[model samples]
Target: MGALLNQTCYLCSNTKNSIVFVENGIDIVRCSNCGHVFSTYEQEEHYEGYWDDDSSYDLGWWDHAHREIYQDFIKRFLTAPSGKILDVGCGLGFLLSEFKIKNPVGKPRVTKYPKKRFNLPGIKTD
Candidate 1:
């Protein structure tokens, strides 16, 4: 069997050595070179769980009222008639979906390259 490659520190970008810091069933790797810290190999998958946690207010919490407020904010400063908007840190396309709902005729787009669950109706993953 091939040897398991250890994950390097995301901050320092070092691969020589690492120190593990385990907390709440998660392992964080700290690099000796720059003293940078990051999670282990399954870091991405691990943090994804935090995003969907019940205690956390993520995409599911965005209701019609929140959409109305967001729309109002957009209309107040933005002059364009909602044409081809891109949400940078789009969590689960809820905001994009809300925007589309508010302006049915307007063009709505989203980027979900990292997260597969966020790819849904009215959202573009590119």
Candidate 2:
């Protein structure tokens, strides 16, 4: 039996009926009650590999999408006169770059994974 078969549902924390979803050699189980989905331990390796692949890390396509969303978020969330804004989980620093360009008068800081440096110019990492 797979690990999911013995585990409780992730949504409602119930130990009752659950549904399994399998795609691209990955397996995830969902709770029927609250509709929460979780992957089994065996699927973690495959999921990590999929994300860690260099091709997956390519940010060209993601940059365009993120830029639009980031702009909208900034317009909606930022209302202070002038303050420091720190962005976390900033993949490739594209959002930070956009924020800086849009808000030249405000202070915007970006935080990223130490090993994953963005290819954009003028992004400083240590």
Candidate 3:
């Protein structure tokens, strides 16, 4: 847990927010102005390969059922899911691999957003 600070909604920068839910002691608040949902605690940068650490195995991540549910949602919502789909914050490239399998017509490239926003894959310019 990190130090709690006065957090304004990043989307609307609105201070008017109320706690909607609390997960792992972090308050998830919803901005009254733009209806943006975010956490109260700031994200602490852990060491490299931090997310891969399953020290808290009870959390039960990497659940294929959840992934399938999301894929089904994508299939239902996004019709033209062709071409390349960018998987920003693609931890361990699991979702990207799944995308490659699900949407073989599309290419998925994983990259960390903002800082290293553009890592263009090798494409035939011709």
Candidate 4:
């Protein structure tokens, strides 16, 4: 178990004003400083080798219903898709895949801080 970094809220950086929303099963803490909710506590050794494989994520992210929802967001927010689309924390590349289908010419750029787990390079968006 990796030591859970639960000292302060990521947004407001306040340690004194936290309330544990769940105390028994898993400590889900909500920071009063910024009203940000976070899950507290993780295994001290966070890295469980091989278990974090991309295929493992694929199974969980198989809910294709999100494609419609993401399409709705694209229709509402993005304009023409001329520039590179930046997808922050692009988990499993579902949204990016949709974007690629919508914009064939524009490049899709994905980013994840610290380390990126997976990259859906050359996605067959069509």
Candidate 5:
């Protein structure tokens, strides 16, 4: 278990909070006032962890695991037939690829690797 964060609740501005659980070395907290679940770890504004690595990173399991979730998300929210989609940190562009397949009229753009954006394995930007 991790220590309680001194910061106030982001939603209701209440200072009272309790630790929900710790996952992957970060403490997940819940606000006592608004019931909002958030992480206690302070993340960098522009944290370039794995996204900055130029080496070939294969996340085949991630694509396979998130396919159904991405499909459901596109069906639920991305209902627009034509629009601009700006995806930041699109690891392997799985979601964008799914979006493109469902809605081919939209201009889907990834912000991670500009030079290699169109070179993702399963993504086809036509």
Candidate 6:
């Protein structure tokens, strides 16, 4: 096992942690207090792996693939009128786009730093 990070757990802020596994060079650790599993790999501000030289990033395939599940989740849990929604690690914002279509007036606010810009129209990232 690689060296376990001395960082505190993001969920419970506990200093005690155990190495779960390592994937592709990143250490996946589990918090002793909250049992929340996360990677210790620090990501760059602007990740370019999703946006390569080809047009794969602009294919819009993820939207179609995840449409049914996103719709179901929206219908089931998002019935409440006064509630805040936060989509973390929201790659390509497909779920957010679906939510906007379902709730035209309500806008999903972005909390995490955008790894890539949203190509989908109508959904505002601000």
Best candidate according to TM-score: 6
Any runs in candidate 5 off by more than 4 Å, and if so which? 1-56, 83-92, 101-126
lDDT digits (tens) for residues 1-126 of candidate 5: 765444566446677778888887677888888897877775444454545556587667888899999888777776787644646343666676665433222113333443254444433332
Task: Show how many residue pairs clash in every candidate, following the order shown.
Answer: 0, 0, 0, 7, 0, 0
Where does candidate 3 stray beyond 4 Å?
1-6, 47-126
Write the number of the candidate with greater TM-score, choosing between 4 and 5. Answer: 4
lDDT of 2 by residue, 1-126 (tens): 344533555334565555476655445767667776765544334444343435546567877777789878777777566634655342555666655422221112232222244433444432
* Candidate 1: tens digits of C-alpha lDDT, residues 17-110: 4546565655566677877676554424544544433444544455544777767766775657755554545354445553543322211222
lDDT measured at residue 111 in model 4 versus the true structure, 0 to 100? 25
Instruction: Compose the digit string of candidate 4's lDDT tens values, residues 20-92.
Output: 5565565677787778787666553553443343444444345366877987888877767563565535265
How well does model 5 score by local distance difference test? 0.59
Model 4: clashing residue pairs? 1-43, 1-44, 1-45, 2-43, 2-44, 2-45, 3-44
Per-model C-alpha RMSD: 10.7, 10.7, 10.1, 9.5, 9.7, 7.3
The sequence of per-residue lDDT tens digits that candidate 6 reaches over residues 33-123 is: 9897877765443454444435444446767788999889988888787544656463655676665432222113332212234444443
lDDT per residue as tens, model 3, 37-123: 877875444334453334454323664546787677567755575644544342544444435333221112212221122222322
The C-alpha TM-scores of every prediction are 0.34, 0.35, 0.37, 0.41, 0.35, 0.44
Best by lDDT: 5
Deviating ranges (above 4 Å) for candidate 2? 1-57, 81-83, 101-123
Error of 2 at 30 (Å): 36
Regions more than 4 Å wrong, model 6: 5-27, 32-35, 42-47, 52-57, 82-90, 100-126
**Shift in Å, residue 55, candidate 2:** 7.4
Q: List the residue pairs that clash in candidate 5.
A: none
Compared with the true structure, all predictions reach lDDT values of: 0.47, 0.50, 0.51, 0.51, 0.59, 0.58
Model 6 worst lDDT window (10 residues): 104-113
